[model samples]
Target: MDLGFSQATAVIVGGGRGMGFATARCLAEDGARVALMGRSPDVLEQAAAALVEFGSPDAVGVVVDTADVGQVEAAFAEVGERWNDGLNVLINTVGPDAVGGFEDLTDEQWLAAVDGGVMGMVRCVRAALPLLRRAEWARIVNFSAHSTQRQSEILPAYTAAKAMVNSVSKNLSLSLAKDEILVNVVSPGSIASEALVGWADSVGVDGSDPYRLMEAIDEHFGHPAHLPRAGLPEEIAPVAAFLASRRNSYMTGANVNVDGGSVFT
Candidate 1:
């Protein structure tokens, strides 16, 4: 169960909060050197500080909007400067959800969903390529959604974008196989993130009570899993952490679903 992350260096995109922060924390606690990259400087700092307290004192937070090419390049440049040799892991976990249906969704909304879901991961992988190539071992874990596999009419654009992410990630796994870099996608179900918690609160549901909030999710979004409750961000993080770890040697081009039996493969 060591997972071989003791000396690993990781860059977690959107590592400021929720599942991103949870994964970063797992790695940090396991003795990995972690760098958190996110849009908000404050959130990144707080997350990094928390990871530092978790025993990754060298943990740093770099601010960058994944949507901006220049910002991503700059942020990775800083990462390269800080950890000159290479990068052991790259985790992208910032895909946004677009709630409108096909006919009701605007062009701008579709564009944003694609940008956030697919292009963001593409940009980070581009920026991290050189560093990954230099590493003795490398792994890439990209977060997608279960909606792509199960099909959801409510989030067509979001699901489409995630589908693209899954396809592109599989291609990347094959492309990077020559370098022995394992690349995989993690498709999670209705995770109780801050936004979901806020939605539950808006509907007068207690987000802290997992069963109640999950019932609310089933009633409102119709996204209930077979486990009878929503999954926690912490629950989803460990799966991604394993994929990003050196222990995951043969798993590539696979979409690991950490959903609570939402989609049967």
Candidate 2:
């Protein structure tokens, strides 16, 4: 399927590893020029190099901590300088996953999660709006969690923050519809990522194999999703790529769930 992404300029926040990196590769493979922005220069460079192997050698990396507005603005400026004038796709994936029960969380923890997850997306979307509006067609894909609707017991801060993301996406979709810039959220079930592994380790279940813990959690949680197994980063990437492409013309203000039917709305 041609996604109509060739020659498109994309900016992927937190594109160093896990789902962000996977999405970067997917966009690059579809012939988009991607600028990978993350906190770690080393990791971002490595991801960029790998993308070059699969897509455009011109794929670039920028070190930017999304938590800091100054850094994010500077990174977007760098992207503009490197890739023509503006971006066609802006995918905000820079936040950390929150764990722990409500009582277990500290004030600092809750604030950090809100700042990183909610405020970070706000800053990215605000900064990228000018560039996105420059394109005839643009997209902003915000990463959210299925746990928000599922009412997962733990991760109160994360869940609340993600819910805000969904709200923000819907609001922005309506505001940006006139500009032809589609904004939407993608909520995924437990995808195999480093964040999930870290959450498992923090729960005192230590082992070299994290998938076991993932499976155990899914089983205990009733595995409501139709798919038997957890999703892969690759599996989630294509949906994001399609959303960001000019091909997805009719989807806006919608929270598309790609959780193997885990979220049947």
Candidate 3:
């Protein structure tokens, strides 16, 4: 299916690895000119090099910590100056998981969660709005968690921050509708990725041997979803690509759950 993304310019914040890299690959494969932004130059270079091999030879990597507003603005400006193309899509795949019960979370932890998850999206969208408005079609897909709907435990700060993301996306959708720039949210459940693995480690779970731990987690929580297994980064990427494309013209302000029906009940 042609997504009408050829020649489109996409800025994927946190596009170094995991779901971010997967989404970047999907978009570029469909012919979008992609700029990968993240904190690590090496990882971003690797991701951009892979994209170059796939199709987008002009794909560039910029080191930008999403948690910092100034860095995000600079990265967007660099993309604008280099590409001389309007921003067609902005995907925020920044993962800021603070593992701990409410009592265990320090003020610093909570603030960081809000900054990385909520304010990060806010900053990127604000910076990209002008460029996005220039495009005939523009999209902003914000990464959220299914836990916000399921109300999972032990993620007070994380859930709160994602809730803010959901709200912000919806509000942006309404405000940007007149300009034809779509804003939407995607919530995925238990996608197997480096981010999830690091989250497990932060929570004191041994995922160094991920095969075993993934099996155990699947046995415990996989039953809720109809698929009876965790999702892969690749599986989540196409959904995001569709949302960021012209094909998803009517889906603004919606929170699409790609959770294998985990939250249906």
Best by TM-score: 1
How many residue pairs clash in each candidate at the backbone level? 0, 0, 0
Query: What is each predicted model's overall lDDT from 0 to 1?
Result: 0.92, 0.82, 0.84
Using lDDT as the measure, name the better of candidate 1 and candidate 3: 1
Show pairs that collide, candidate 1: none
TM-score of 3: 0.92
Better of 2 and 3 by TM-score: 2
Ranking the candidates on TM-score from highest down gives 1, 2, 3
For candidate 2, lDDT tens digit of each residue in 182-204?
99888888776786666656766
Model 1 CA deviation exceeding 4 Å by range: none
Once fitted onto the true fold, the runs of candidate 3 whose alpha carbons sit more than 4 angstroms away are: 198-215, 218-224
TM-score of each: 0.98, 0.92, 0.92
> Tens-digit lDDT track for model 3 on 191-231?
77786666557666665554544554554434245565567
Residue pairs in candidate 2 whose N, alpha carbon or C atoms collide under 3 angstroms: none
Give residue 252's error in model 2 in angstroms.
0.7
Best-first order by lDDT: 1, 3, 2
Native-vs-model 2 lDDT? 0.82
